[model samples]
Target: MSQDHSQDHSQDAGAALAEGRGRSAGARSSDQAPSLRPSLLDPLFAPARGLPGIGPKMAPMIERLLGTPERPARIIDLLFHLPQGGVARRLMGSISEAPPGEPVTVGVTVTGYRAPQAGPGKRPYRVLVEDPTGDITLVFFGMPAPRVEKMLPLGSHRYVTGRIDLWDGHRQMVHPSRIVDEAGFAALPAVEPVYGATEGLTSRAISKLAHAALDRLPVLPEWQDPAWLRQNGLPAFAEALRAEHKPDGPPPPVATDGTVPATPARRRLAYDELLASQLALALTRARSRRGPGRQNAGDGGLLGRIEAALPFALTGAQTRALGEIRADLGSDRRMLRLLQGDVGSGKTAVALLAMASAVEAGRQAALMAPTEILARQHHDRLTAMAGPLRLRLLTGRDRAAERRATLSDLAEGQVDIVVGTHALFQESVAFRDLGLAVVDEQHRFGVHQRLALGAKGQAVDILVMTATPIPRTLALTFFGDMDVSVLDEKPAGRRPIATRLVSTDRLDEVVAGLGRALQAGEQVYWICPLVAESEYVDLAAAEDRFADLQAEFGAVVGLIHGKMPGPEKDAAMERFAAGDTRILVATTVVEVGVDVAQATIMVIEHAERFGLAQLHQLRGRVGRGAKASTCLLLYRGPLGQVARARLEMMRETEDGFRIAEEDLRLRGEGEVLGTRQSGLAAFRLARLESDGDLLEVARDDARLVVERDPALRSERGRALRVLLYLFERDAAIRLLGAG
Candidate 1:
């Protein structure tokens, strides 16, 4: 929205604007309400249904797009929903001067209306409108003639705004977006904001609601440092937000360079959101530090045994990571750290050593996985690696007798370490003295689950691990509350997989080549195209491919998919793990934490259908053992730009960190970490790709604010409290003791 457009809407909305927009003077007295939220934010936080022109029926539709189960859509949410772009309306005197496929606003008189034949399959209703220079047809499909006639009354001069296209060599417009009289046309801006539409809602309706929401903004005090705001040339909070909602002219949402215009308004608002997120994280970190940490780092007695038993030496990166994690464990402050390592970068060894450190201190440790298969895999790997400590496996699939015994052993301190799924956090399970908790694939379980596990013990140190290497920018946004440790080196004796791009046209040759791998007693993982959108389609694809491979390889081929029963899926995985089956045909269910040492060959069908990060993960499945590995990406011809780039990047480098950065550059933040899949709230205003620099500055600023005003008693500190609540970071506000 442009500034001119905002004024136009505000002019007519003055009559509807509330008399007391901000908080009353009486409400801000010394005896203010005990609520953490200030009274000034009431208007902005009001229910969207109360807005003008919004009916009860339309409220649910708005809520479906932006609401959560706990909270419905509010006026603030509508305000945050910014425009995608704008269409510039070029005022033309006549139709003859209108460019062929360009937006034009021309004054024309409605001459007549032409209705189509009454039938299911028929042409659109046409209206004849003309100027003195030339004439153009106005088309509306599936619209009643009466409505069309009423809208464009005959002999009425109106401004028609929309793109003019030469259809069948005749100048016509399928839909004239706006056909308003002179008075209505005068209110329309040259650049009209374009909004994304949802089911049962139109962009025009949303724009109206958003405009009404904007009128409720109150005068907010500046929360940012005065010197810093001047140094950055930033606008005030309300001014920046208003500028974003109302655009005036050049530099639309997307500029001609195919990049978002880093206008002053956008930069200011982006900084505001980044500041809120970073401040909340800083407060959370402060609270986490106030807890008494268990001094779990003991003399390297158990850790020495594991290191001595390993066949290969630890990488420099892994050694550095252990030093950092051990330092945190030794300090009195509670340890909340992230152990980030690329796929097969030896993170498990580091985790095992960290767990061993806790056990050496006579405290229990537990590793939680997201799935039962992963939990069991971790159990098997740890049992083989860990020779001395008593380790137990607990999962939802365990029999009642086995589960009861494991629980008894855990409570009695007989189990020194345990690996399981979310079952570890069940209320019935009690830990004698749990000193450390390591969560695998931290993106799958968010902060709530971490806190749930922490409740079982006293200040239990947490070290969440991710095989998907995250870029530094996203590291701040997702794991801002925790310290980070990255393992960048691959261990000794690990071989790089030779990646090859193959066309689907040579399917027969690829299958014949798999025969040699099978005959050599080498394990193979044959993956089908990613489940496009549904599981049923994914199941069929995997089964169909498994059938074809089974016919060729007799009984040695097995299939695994997410839809199969747990035991059945486990059986297929066990056969592949034990070398009973040489080839495993599967879907993306094997994407994460499924380790098979002998699986040397990975064949991904329709590789173009997968994202770069996913393709990298699948390739990591191989090259785990000392044997040389090969990854074949079978893609169809005429690949699109993004898909082609993904395959090329896969062939270019095996560095997961570099791949992660490229993934962020190619795609957005969502694909890099699977934000929606992980159930983590994404920043509604900040674009990580463009605003990463702001994140670093915001982080530093937040640290400074927390250090200076620990309780937020200062004037600027009080304003910052409103900033937190404005972004719905009220969870962090409650920690401030309701200033």
Candidate 2:
């Protein structure tokens, strides 16, 4: 976890895992333009060891705190280190007027000194100081006698600054933060900036390093729109960085409750960061569409065949989503689209139809799932409904002979559609005319992995699908490059899940009710909060619950969790699917894409511990069947406002989109569970809740600039390119060159 000293800079200062790890700079783009590095920023990108005081011993310490494991701390990283807050140390006229415990500077005469004895047991060297209002003791834990005598001769006047305390029946100053002569007093800041510190690195030391960084600030062309900056009354980027580091007066006022305020200077810096991110995404989107796209238009022959084979009709939302994807596939520009829906919202059907279109165009399509179970699930479902379209399943679990045959068939273009996990991206899994690349549960795969898969086929149309409905802010940050189509409606006959919150103290009553439901021949799902008993967590474990349920239900209850072997988990799921077991107790391993039509009960243990969106997903498991489904959210008592709000929202509505929006507002975007792995740009200064208004402005600005100047050759564009490098979006610039 990152420690914030003055304010939360987790988004800004946090070293994000590199955008697409394992991607070589040469491999990403075949651009003709010069390298993304413009000669002007070389000094900033230089190694931290090049800094005057940063020797070998100190460099590693700084890197550990500020740099990523992949890259050492650079001078540029130090340049972006904004102060956390300000510390005020205004000079007080006399010790009598100085407020106790508050920092104050005082002028005093060194009246006398008490040196430690020649041989002693932990004695401090004390110096006596006096002024017109009062006298005070200066305490130093350790000081060489000769040096101390030379510095503070008896009766010599000196300036001391530190927090004063009433000690041992007299006033005293412990280890003065600053002691200066008359000339040095004139240069001391009335208020100083406070920064986060690491071991062996003092706040004062960090402040000195930051000042050194500011001294090297280069004069550059303006990047922001002149009108926006003028209207906002914001300073230039360089001026803003300087002003934030050194306030002219007392520090900006924090809220009475101690929350950090978004001062104008801070907001300006925030805008710069947000603007950089928005611009990079806009550029990437533009680059993806720069070249002529492969128009894999089909005659709908294969789609018609698959549709005829389906057991049920398509939902209106799914049909509309399919239309959008079809249009993208037909267009001259490559299709980079995102398909979002709630759990069990039929995303796979749309994906299968899209793949059929690719096959009709004489091109093979591949669907990559994040897990083997989900991949196999896709293969099974599609195999039954795909009609005559040739389909194959590829996974690590495949036998060597089977795998070799599948690979040969895929390379020879005999397989029309292939479904698999990350193994699909293996070097050996070659495609003869790969057209569409569909990624299921895209949040689990990083951006680089997606790119690697896309690189497998030139101008391959990319379609990413996510079952978790993401909020608008997150969508913009993570999938800004893709056109989005949402499956907002469930198919007809899918009943609204009846959700209820119950206290865990009433577990016995709930169990008795489950017994009755079992007697009525209705299937039940008992979801626990954890897989095993953890010393740190308080929630009930699935294994313990499965044992208890097995004891009571006599072999009718089934169990599965993430920790179990694949075959064992498959067996348990098969038992539940086949109705051999009526009650299945499990952990969240069944959170996504697990389908059991006969199951009608969802008992989520400690639901208050889950996010509102997660609770909604778990609840979605049961409503797939025709029978009425009840989602019993069993939670412990003494809930906080946020957790209570989450549970209340789940009880009130089944709309995943609405739940997602509420989740964003209730917990902010950081704790949404998937953003970290989604490779979304995490905002350092911009709060999505409060700074949402700026997103549109920044996005619009970025679009206009990229549309007018793709290569960043214009005066303003050059400066914007610098902004890109500063925020580590140089990858986007490389995309422009490749285009």
**Which is the leading candidate under TM-score?**
1
Error of 1 at 540 (Å): 5.6
Model 2 backbone overlap count: 2
Clashing pairs in 2: 11-684, 12-684
lDDT by residue (tens digit), candidate 1, 1-739: 2211100011001011111212221113344433457878988877777888878789888877655554557788778877665666557867999877756788898998888976677679998999999899999986788898889998998888887998888889887867888788777765676666576676668778888888999888899888988898988988876666676773354643344667777788888888888887888777767767879888987799888997679999999999999998888888989999989899888999999999999999999999889999999889888989899999988999999999999999999999999999999899999999999987776456777787788889989999988889888877887789999998878898999999988999999999998888799998886423455553227777888999999899998888889899999999999999999999988988899989999999989877788889999999998799999999988898778988999999999999989888877776676654544345566778888899999989988999998777799888998887776566676666633
Q: For residues 46-119, write the lDDT of model 2, one tens digit per residue.
A: 65556677776777767766666445566656656666667565678798998787667898999999877667
List CA RMSD, all candidates.
Answer: 7.0, 7.1
Cα deviation in Å at residue 372, candidate 2? 1.5
> On a 0 to 100 scale, what is the lDDT of residue 442 in model 1?
77
Model 2 score (lDDT) = 0.79
In order of appearance, the predictions have TM-scores of 0.86, 0.78
Instruction: Say which candidate scores most in lDDT.
Output: 1
TM-score, cand. 2: 0.78
